[model samples]
Target: MPFYDIYSEDVRCGRGASKSGEETKTAEVFAGDEVGFVVGRSAMEPLEPHLIYHNGPGQVYLSQSTAADVREYEGDGNWFKISYHGPTNDSWWSTRDQTGMNFTIPDSTPPGQYLLRVEHLYVRYPIGTTQFYIACAQINVRPPRNGTVGAKTPSPEYMVRFPGGLAVPEYMYEWPNTRLTEYKPPGPALWTG
Candidate 1:
């Protein structure tokens, strides 16, 4: 029940997560669905995809009866990275040629509402000019085809908050440094479930 209105939304999609996200248009998906993550791009960079849930901010996934009993999935900093696309060769990023990304909702995820989050960092200008683009889509996940649900949400060991999760060097500059053989995006590790 903390403040979910990320001011950045003001320049984009605000108003929804401002209150009790329950009012937001929640997209319904099955546990094993292939969820696509996209946030139009003007340059070649990297994007990280994540699925997040909140069970009373302290509780754990208990049952379908209480699956969606929590507030809307918004900015709680609690989330698991589903996937990420970053530099491939020195001159390009693997996601550079694509308009969006396709990711599967973890099959073992408990049935409930979640926030599908995507983050892209633009380091075209290097230091002080880099930009960060973030988008979160609200979703309600049901059980899989087998109708099985996990006893609990993935442990906090695999989860990380947003702002604090992506703590990278403020002076990160990747323009000429594009030839990265090792690229680790600025967030939590990927939790495949």
Candidate 2:
């Protein structure tokens, strides 16, 4: 995992904490495989536990990408929101006290290289919820066991950039005291294929 060390905190309060990933070494996965990333440090919980991916050319080397910037691509949308973990009626937050956030690769996902992004917006921090922590890992997804399922090309509305993708909700401004009866992770909805 290419996670910037916790000691790197002094580097701008947790924005863009990506430690460059490996080019040759990549996590191999098949469609429908449940993959996850553990938080680098225990003190960190994957708030909003937003997991998204971008299938780009070459190592898919990108720290951030917006829908507009991705339109130039040849096929599926650049970034796809695979999953989002948030608070529930019974739990304060879904990602609390868990090994990590797990998401199944949609069966229709094309077999190729992609950038898996795990990000968390630290809500209760000296810096506030806007404090963003992000890490990108390289993975090579193989064909689904059933066969090559036709993948759907996600629309531009289904993609979002990292830094600007998560827009802080109005309730989070006064966080710690914000009455969050329902916490929805900010970003486009998950693109389930």
Candidate 3:
């Protein structure tokens, strides 16, 4: 029955607001058990429609994945509704509240870290739809008493390589104080000077 919080970093309320980035919160839970988490408003205002839904908004997705085998659970394929403030609803204006749903992790799932992807989408007219933002969470599920699973390898570091040799540093050559007429070209004795 461990609890966690999920919220957006830069919540905005307008049509032209940017919707490119998202933040994810992760937790560890046991297999064959229900992992309870909360998604609500951290501030006094709920996530508005104009900010998220430019055209037509749809139900937010709570996707789950695992490192081991994929097994079906009781609430695995179900879609839950999250109540939102309609455009015309004035009774509960500017109040930050949340509705929640319960889902159970499958007992047949493997004992390893699983990923849960949460995305917000909108369906617009003329065009089909697009995902505005996406966030993810990792859950470590323990194996059953008699079950065994393998561990995961760490991710590799990202690097960039230049095609040619490294870029040459810029150098500035300045001539000493001498008139063009007074300057004489270097001869074979230039190295001796």
Give the count of colliding residue pairs in each prediction. Answer: 2, 0, 0
- Candidate 3 lDDT over 1-193, as tens digits, reads 1111112222111121123212323366664455433443335555652233222112221223422422221112212121222222212111123232234554444455444333332222222122233333455566544454333222122111111111111110122211222221111111100
Residue 82 alpha-carbon offset, candidate 1, angstroms:
1.0
Model 2 alpha-carbon drift over 4 Å, by segment: 1-19, 22-24, 42-77, 124-129, 165-181
Error of 2 at 17 (Å): 7.1
Q: Least accurate stretch of 10 residues (summed lDDT) in model 2?
A: 54-63
Q: lDDT for model 3, please.
A: 0.28
lDDT of 3 at 24: 29
> How many angstroms is residue 81 displaced in model 3 relative to the true structure, after the best TM-score fit?
17
In candidate 1 the C-alpha lDDT for residue 97 amounts to: 42
Model 2: per-residue Cα lDDT over 20-136, one tens digit each: 332225577787778777656433535654332210001111112222322222122246677676554322455544545677888877666666666654543233324444545
Tell me the spans in candidate 3 whose CA falls farther than 4 Å from its real position. Answer: 1-26, 41-98, 128-133, 144-193
Q: Highest lDDT among the candidates is held by which one?
A: 1
Q: After superposition, how far is residue 180 of candidate 1 from its true place, in Å?
A: 2.3
Candidate 2 Cα deviation (angstroms), residue 51: 18
lDDT at residue 144 of model 1 (Cα atoms): 85
RMSD of 3: 25.5
Count backbone clashes in candidate 3. 0
- Which has the better lDDT: candidate 1, or candidate 2? 1
